[model samples]
Target: MVGLLLVVTLLTYIIPAGQYARDTAGNILTDDQFSYLDEQTPVSILDMLMLLMDGLIS
Candidate 1:
């Protein structure tokens, strides 16, 4: 029936039937954290805009 078919389709998506997807996401998150730690100084958008304006006006 339509209801049984819907249940089967939903189950297929909600199941973590593969390990590759999980491991890939974990690797990406770890890499992101490592890069964030490596950056010594981070610039804000406002600071960048101010610097650009100073360069242009001068």
Candidate 2:
């Protein structure tokens, strides 16, 4: 359906960023330091879910 296609298109841009962040946490931020950044971050469960879907598409 059109909705699914739209979701897939959006996810394509999100998932990699999450993976990149997780992988580069040490380079970008330390563990406790990163936790503070995560709190300030606006990412939500829906955002995480979309990232997961994006991974599947990739």
Question: Which tens-of-lDDT digit does each residue in 1-54 have in candidate 2?
Answer: 547756665665564432233445456633443322222244555776687689
Report the alpha-carbon TM-score of model 2 versus the true structure.
Answer: 0.30
Off by over 4 Å in 2: 1-39
> Which RMSD does model 2 reach against the true structure?
10.2
How many clashing residue pairs are found in candidate 2?
0
What's the number of clashes in each of the models?
0, 0
RMSD score of candidate 1 (Å): 19.2
TM-score of each: 0.30, 0.30
* Candidates' RMSD to native: 19.2, 10.2
